[model samples]
Structure formats: structure tokens, C-alpha cells
Target: MKIDARSVARILREPGALRVILLHGDDSGLIRERARLAATAIAPNLDDPFRVAVLDRDAADRLDEEIFALSLAGGRRVVWVRDGGDSLTAPLKASLARPSDTLVIVEAPGLASRARLRALAEAQADCAAIACYPEEGRALEASIRQMLAEEDIRIDPDALSWFAGLLGPNRAATRGEVEKLALYAGRGGQLSLDDVRMCIGDAAGVSLEDAAFAATAGDRAGADIAIERALAEGTSPIAVARSLLSHLHRLRRARIAMDGGQSRADAMRGLRPPVFFKRTDAFGQALSLWTAARLMEAAEQTQRLELECKQTGAPDLALCRRHIARLAATAMAGRRR
Candidate 1:
């Protein structure tokens, strides 16, 4: 049967006799996490991961033979197939016929169009297929807010503005950046903007928030300096560009959610923390002056910069500095009007 992402936790708690699971998504974090959870749930008694047979998509077609003949000796056997060529192509309905002692975890990017896979999964009395896509609309935001609450992290209104502005489109990346902030708090048992700033602190004496602030505030020179510092300290230009893009994308998403009548409290609840608090003044300014179209244009620019950083080599740092600084400055200037 099909399992929705929201109900995954409950499903894990009571697996209900499914021996085969397919967890796939464009979002890497969610995919692997659910895959691991399923693997463990099936073999809750497993102490050694080696007993599990892992078959990559590239493995010879002998996979079926291997699986059929394989025994875990004493432990349970798990045949995990990734980048599923044969796994995705093989008759999925037929594949489910396996010993109860073994659980098969199949992970792919997204296979919604594959009618056979979908039908087989839906018809199965003992299998599940879950689709993991980028988090969106109200549900995603709520998850972000709830994750923080569960983590014991307190996010105030201003901080939420900054965080919601920088939240990633996917739970995996979103959770990853939050963990960085949590680690930044350093056992302090509390999360503040400074904790995020310090934890995300890179070679750029300027924090992720700073570049974001400069971008929204139109402070090109300030942005330039931040980019320069970040580069001098050994941070990759591509990395910085990607970070900026993620921040801007989050803001764009928030603006849409708000327009849809989602309350700021509800919106903030879904945002991950450490949004570079110092950038709130700047980001708020941009949010006020620019339409969603303008912000998305800026998002595109950051994406372009990422490509340039990857393809060009002509004093690449200078190229990055110029655009990033301009982007930062534009972001700040956006707030002006």
C-alpha cells in the first residue's frame, strides 16, 4: 500500500507486516532517513549491518539469484537496491515474493509515472511505496516549526522572520542547516541568533545572515567584503552562492505562503531557526518593497552565479565576489523601495 510521508512515523512504530519498502525522493535526506528506518524496523534485532545484503543498481542481473540463495546465517537479511536499474525495471510484483526473514528496501529518485510499480505497490498486501518531494505549503512549514519545538529550540518572531527567510525547500537540507545552528549553540541549551551566526560562521567574518542582509539591503561593498572574507578563509565560492540561493528561495516561499492567508505565527512555526537575525532588518525591507517576481529573479541570479563558479576559472573568486556582492547589495536595496 502507499504510505504518505506525514504518517511515516506511525507506520514505523507499527510496521504491520510489510517486508518490502520503496522510499524514493528528490530530497536526499528524507529518502535515506526513511530507508534506514525501514531497514532497522524489519530487523530490529540486528546488531551487525554487514548481514544485510546491499545491491546497487549496477550490480549484475544475478541479483535475483544472489537474493534467492542468500541466507543471513543467523541474522536477518536486507537486500537494499539503490539507483535501481534492475530493481526498478524488474517485475515489481514478482520481486515481493521473498522470505519473511528478509526485507528489501528499494530507493529511487521518483517513479510516479511507472504504472507497474505504482500498481504493484498499491495492490500489495505486504509492501509499501512512499513518495518524498520537496516540502511545500502549510504542511512543510508546520513540520519545521514542530521539529524545533521538539528539539527544545525557542524561535521568537524576529528570529522566525530570519529563519523562515532562509529555510530550504526540503526537510533534509532544512534539518541539516538547523543542526548546524544547534551545534553552534554549543551545549548552551538555548538557541539564539548569535548561536546560529557563530555556528554557521565560515571564513567570511560575515555570517550567512550578513551576506543575506547585504543582498537584501543593497550594500554591495559590505557584501563584497563579506564574500572576500569568506573566500580568504577557505570557503568555496560555490558554497556561498548556494547558501545565498537557499536563503532567498525560503523567503520567496514564505511570501507565497503568507499571501495564501497563512498566519505569520503559522508560517514562523514551520520555519527552521538561525535565519541570520542580523539580516531581518534587510530581509524585511526586501519583503516589503519587492514583489515575489523580483525575489525569484534574484533567486535565479544566485543560481547562475553557482554555475559560473563551477564553469569559469578566470579569477573565479573575483567573478563570484562581483555578483555575490551585487546580489547582496540588491537584496538590501530591495528593502529600500
Candidate 2:
């Protein structure tokens, strides 16, 4: 059976009669977290050798033995498979065909919809497939509030909105940042806009945005520094490319609005989530230098940069630097003109 977002928490906590559960999605952190919830629900002491078994792709062949083995402690067992893929389809299918009390949890990040493993889990009456994707907009805001509330902290509305915009695309990263804020505020504390900025302004996502803004505003040195900081903080080169692409798309939208007779301020104001106040000038400068048509061309180049970075053995970091340098040069030339 396929699990919906609303039912995910309930199903993970009390998966009645569920033999095999597959958690797969773009958000690896969420998948792993949910898998832990399910595993611990079945076997509270995950370290108990007789009640739990953890396996990777290398030991996937032992799936049958683990699933069928009974717990010596006389409780439900959990077999956890990490980094799963289509390779486990046959083994999983065979295990699901039989009857067992043990719960098998498969954590497959980045699995496709048509994947055999996912399909098998969804088709089985005693199995479930859950998709874990990054939360956005209201969902993200709600999640942040929930996390803070757990620690008995409250956030101002303006601070919440600003903080959400600065968050990265990963759930685990977001949770870590929110936890850090909670600690800073202490229990029963309230957070202000300045509090969040002081706490999380230098996060990897912020640095990535800094690199994007600098590259499009003709600041080669600033772009280089921001990119270095983002990479050093464990941001992927692919993420950097996507950030640049997103900024160019935003610039294209603003340029189109300007060409349609809207003033610069109006176009910038029209942006969804609104441009961060601190970057307003840089964003406006980039908008001035880019025509809608030229921005589209640059977006296509960035799309290619992302694809190239995915290739085996590609010098991803060097490619990202070169691409940012090119954008900076283009912006400088446009300014000169």
C-alpha cells in the first residue's frame, strides 16, 4: 500500500500487520528518520542482536534468513536495509511472499516511482511504500513550529517567515538548525527576527545564495569567497549550480516585469517569498544587467552545468567555480556597456 503524508506518522508508529515497509524519496534524511521510528517501534532496543539486524547492499543476500529468524527475547524483530535500490527487488519480493511477524524496513533514497522495489512493496497487501520529500511553504513552517514547541520555544511570525526562507532543502539539516535555535533561546524562550539572523544567517544555504547574488552582480571575488565557504561547509557542487540557476530564473522574472512597464521596486516586490532585504540592492543590480532572453540562455548553461557535475569523475568543484566566473564576467561586461 502507498502511504500519504498525513498517515505517515501513524503508520510508522503503529504499522499493524505490515511485513515489509519501504521508505524512499529525495529526502534521505526524512526517510532515515521515519525508518528509525518504525524500527524502534518494533524493537525498542535496536542494539539487541536477537531482535534487530542491520544490513547494507553488500549483505542483502541474507534478507531471507533475517526476516524468517525468530527473536530469542520473544518480541517482534526488525530487519533494517540501508541504501537499498532495485537490486533488492527479488529478495524483497521473495520475503514478502511468505508470512512473518518480523518487520523489514528498507531505506532507499532517490528511488524512482517506477522502481521494482517500490512497486513490489506497494502492491503487497502486507507491505507499504512511503515517499519522503522536502516540506515547503506552510508545511515547512508548521514543522519548524512543531520542533520548537517540543522544546517549549516560541517564534515571532516575522522571524518564522525569514527563518524559513534561509532553510536548506534537507529535512535533517533543517531540524539541526531549528534545534540549535531552540538551544540558544533556552526552554520557554521567544525568538525575534534578529535572534534567528544572528543564529543561522551563515548557514550553507545562505552562503550558496550569497555566491549566487555575487556572481550575478559582477563581484567575482565575493562569489569565489562565498562559494568556498559553502563548499567547505559540506554543500554539494550540484547544489551550488542549482542555486545559481534559481537566481537567474528569479532575475528573468523580474526583468520580464520591468520590460512590461513595472518599476524596479515593483518587480522585486512581486517576487514570491520576497527578496531578502539585505540582498535587495544586489538583486536589483543583477536585474538591471540581465535581459529576459539573456537570462534564459544563462539558465540553460547552468542546467548543463548540473548535468555535467553528475558525471563520474567530473571535477565538480572546478566546474562550479568556472561557471560562476563566467557569470561574473558577463555581468561586468553588461555593466561596462
Candidate 3:
């Protein structure tokens, strides 16, 4: 059956009697996270190699062998398939024809409506297909709260709102940032907006906002330092790329509004997250520098870099940082012109 996003959390909490769970989404991080949660629900000891068996689509044909095989850890086995698509349809169908103690999870990219693999999972009994897309607005806020709660950390509402704006389109990235905040705040600590900013500090221990601000404001040196520090601290390249894209998009929107005769103050005021008070003048300058066409070009570059980061066997992190730095340099040149 097809599982709704709202129902996924409850089901994950108690996935009882389900045999096959297929998670397909554009949010690769969320897909992997849900798969991991489902696997752990079934096979508690994930560290036990015997209890967890991760396979590629090429191993689909051996599903029966893997699932039915007795676990060396002597409990339920988790048969996980990463990057699944149409190639595994036949093998999956054959394996699901019968049942066993193992819980099978197939993590796939966004599937088309007519995709047979998605259809098979939805149509079959004892199987479920979940669609995960980018979470935003309230959903993003809720997820942030939940993750923080788990770490026994509390966040101020303003800080939560600010942090939420900085995350999503990637659940793993969102989770990672939250984890860092928790670590910085120490156990059982309350997180203020300043704390949130400091924990997300840059190359010289400045915040992510500082880097994003510098890059967009055409400060190449500051952007380079921030990007380098963020990457060195284990921030994913895709995360940084996404943020840059968001920043550019915001600038584009504001610039477009101004072109349509809206006043600068009015344009910035209409932004959803609302530009921080201190940055209003700088944001206005970005509006002047980044034309609509220039914004589109920036977005395209950021997206391409994100794709590289997600590609298999790619040194995505370094590539992402380098691309962002180049973008920073380009912005600096644009300002000079």
C-alpha cells in the first residue's frame, strides 16, 4: 500500500507485520534515514553484520538467499537495497511472493507515476511505498523540534524559525546541523538564537549566515573562509549548495519585486523568513547586483554542483566547496563591475 507522509512516523514507530518497505523520494537523506530507522526497528543490533545486509540493485536477484538465510546474530535480519529502480522489479516481485522473518527496505530516487517498481510495492500485500519530498514551513519546524527533543536540547522559537529556514530539501543535512547545535550546547542545555548562530560558525568560526552573507554581498575572502571552515567541520557540500541557491533565489525575488516598482523596504518585508534587521542594507545591495538573469545562472550552477555531490564515487564535498568559492569570486567581480 502507498503510505502517506503524515502516517510514516507512526508506522515507523510500529512497523509490525510489514515485510517490504520501499522509500522513494527526492530527499535522499530522508530516504536513507527512514530506511535506517525501519531496519533498526526490525533488527535492533545494526552493528551486527549478520543482522544487517546492505545490497546494491545488482544483488536483487539474491534477495531470497539473503532474507531467508539465518541471522548470525540470531534475530530478525534487515535486507536493505540502496539505489533501487526498475532493474530490481522482477527480483523483488519474486522474493515478495513468499514471506520470511526479514524486513526488506528499498531506497529509491523519485519514481515516475508509471514506474513498475513503485506500482508493485503499492499494489502488493505486506508491502508499502512511501514518497518523501522536501519538507518546508511548519513541517520543517516540527522536524527540527523533534530532532532537538531527542537530544534533550531545547531551542528558542525565534532560533527554531531561523534554523528551519537554513535547513531542509535534505533531511540528513537538517539532522546533522541539529546534532552539531546539540553538541555545542552540551547536554540538557537551552539553545538561544546566538547559540544557534555560533555553533554554525564558519572557517574562522563564524556562522553559516556570515558565509552566505559574504558570498552574496561579494566578499570573496570571507566566503572562502566560511565555506572552507564549514566543509572542514563535516558540513555536506549539498547542504552549502542548497543554502546558496536559496540565498540567490531570495535575492532574485526581491530584485524582481523592485523592478516591478515595489520599494526596497516593501520588497524585503515581503520575504517569508524576513531578512534579519541588520542585513537589510546589504540585502538591498544584493538586490541591485543580482539581476533576474544572474540569479538564474547562480541557481543553475548551485544545482549542478549539488548533483555532483550526490553522484556515486564523486568527491562531492571538495567539489561543492570549490564551486561555491568560485561563485563567491564571481559575485565579488560582479560587484566590482
Candidate 4:
């Protein structure tokens, strides 16, 4: 059966036989947790989740052969495939059809509806698909409220918004931060924003979000510093640059669509995964700051910097420091014109 993230807790109730599950999202922790829960449901004992097998993309061929040949070791078997590509091998795709006694689970990053495995699963009578994504709106806010309620902690509504703004949309990050905050409060006391600031170590807030915000707002100085801080704090330059490029690209598309008379809401339609509401606002801010000329410059600069970071042996730390500084300075200057 096909299922959404909401049904994960319920679907995981399946305790035996072969199950093929596909789980994935930007949130690595939830993907892992769901996978673990599924496996545990089938085999409570780690020592002998009898005949349990996990296969990554690299081992699909071998795992396919193994599956084609194997039998249950006097107990239920589970074959898990994690970090899958957009499609699986033909043999593997065929296997997902007509669910077997051996459970099959697949985890893909952003596989589409047309993916071969997805096609196979949809066609199969016994198979199921479960879709997962970050929590949002009332759902996300309610989750925070529920977590606090369990801890006998009360929080201000604004603080919850603040917390959500900082944490992004990953369920795993939210759970981790909630756990940490609970530790600090010790099942008592009214939770305040200060407690959130003190205990929750989620990678939300002014790291990437700040850097992106600064860059978009033409705060050259802040952008430079924030970029450096973000990189030092383990943020990948490529990822940030990619984020920059992605939003810029979208802004360009959105702008053109708008010029052709499309509203922001309409322009964003059908965007894969859809742009987050905050991101749409940020994109607007960036468009206001960056003219086509400025974006061209920013894109070119980021591209060159990416090349240098990858190809040359110079101190990446220093190079990225200066490159980002210059990019920010250039962007900041654009708003003045």
C-alpha cells in the first residue's frame, strides 16, 4: 500500500514477512529512525533480525542476486535498500512487484513519480509507497506544542514561531532540539525563549539562514562575516553556493514570469517540492537587491570561486573567506544603484 509520512508509525506495525519500504527526505535523522523502526518491528532482537539485509546503491546488483537466490533462515527476512537512485536496476524493479515474504525497503533522496521502482511499486498489488517531508504550518506548530505539553512545559506562541524559524523544517532536528530542551527543564518549569536559546542546539537560526538573508539584503559586511562563520561552523561552501545559485535561478525565472504578468503565487506553481513561504519572500528580497547584471556577476564569481576551491591547492579557508566577502560586497553595491 502507498502511504504518507503520517502513516509511518502505523505502517511500521508490520512485524514479519518481507517488506520493501522506501523512505527518504532532506531530514536524515527521520529517514534513519523510520528505517530502524521498520526493522525493529520485524525483528525485535538486534542479534537476530533473522536474515536481515541492508543494501545501498552500490550494492544493488549484489543484493539483487542475493535476493534472487536466498531463502528465509528459518525466520522472517528483510531486505533494505537505502540511498537509492532515481531508479533501480531492472531485476530489482521486477522484484518489488508481487510482494514477497522477504520485506523490501527503499530510501531515495528525491525520486520522482516516474521513477522505475515507484512505477513498479504502484503497479504491484501488495506493495506500498510512503511519502515523507518536513512539517509545516499548524502541523509543525502543533508538534512543538505537543512536545512541550508532554514535558509539563508551557511556551509562548511567539517563541514557538521563533523556534520554528530557527530550526528549518527537518523533523529530526526538531526532535533533537526538543529532547535537549527537555533535559534542561527536567520535566518542570515554564519554558521560555531563553530556555530555547540555552538548550536547543539545533542547526537552525542565523547560520545558513542568516548568511542567505544577509546576502539577499545587500549587507556586504555582514554577509562576509556570516559566510566565514558559516563555513567555519561546518557549512559547505558548495552547498551554500548551490543554495545561492538555486534561489538566484528561481528569482530570474520568477522575475521573467512576473514580467510576462504572472503573480508571485502563480509563478511559484509547480516548483518541485514547492518553494517555502519564507523562501519566496527571501527570493523577492534578493530580486530587489540584485539586478540581472549583479546576478550575472554573482553567479560568475561563485562559479569561479567554486572552481578554485576544487582545483587549486591554496588554503580553502582563506580563499572562501575572500571570495564570499567580495561576492557580498558586490551584491551590497547593487542595491545602491
Who wins the lDDT comparison?
A: 2
Each candidate structure's TM-score, on Cα atoms with residue i matched to residue i, is 0.60, 0.77, 0.68, 0.58
lDDT of 2: 0.88
Each prediction's RMSD over C-alphas, in Å, is 8.1, 4.0, 6.0, 10.0
Q: What range of 10 consecutive residues in model 1 has the weakest lDDT sum?
A: 200-209
Q: Write the per-residue lDDT of candidate 4 for residues 144-178, one digit (tens) a residue.
A: 78887888877766566556555544566678777
- Tens-place lDDT digits, model 3, residues 1-337: 9998778987776788788898997989999999988988987777778889899978877877887888865878888999998887887788777768688889997777789999999998788899988787788999888888887889998788778766636787777788888889887889987777768743222345566777777777877777777667555566677677777888888888988999989999998667877778778877766778888898898899888888988988678667767767777777778
Question: Lowest-lDDT window of 10 residues in candidate 3?
Answer: 201-210
Give the per-residue lDDT of model 2 (tens digit) for 164-261.
75565688888899998998999999998778878887788789889899989999999999989988887777777767776898899999999999
Better of 1 and 4 by lDDT: 4
**Deviation of model 2 at 196, angstroms:** 2.1
lDDT of 4: 0.64
lDDT assessment of candidate 3: 0.79
lDDT of each candidate versus the true structure: 0.62, 0.88, 0.79, 0.64
Clashes of 1: 18
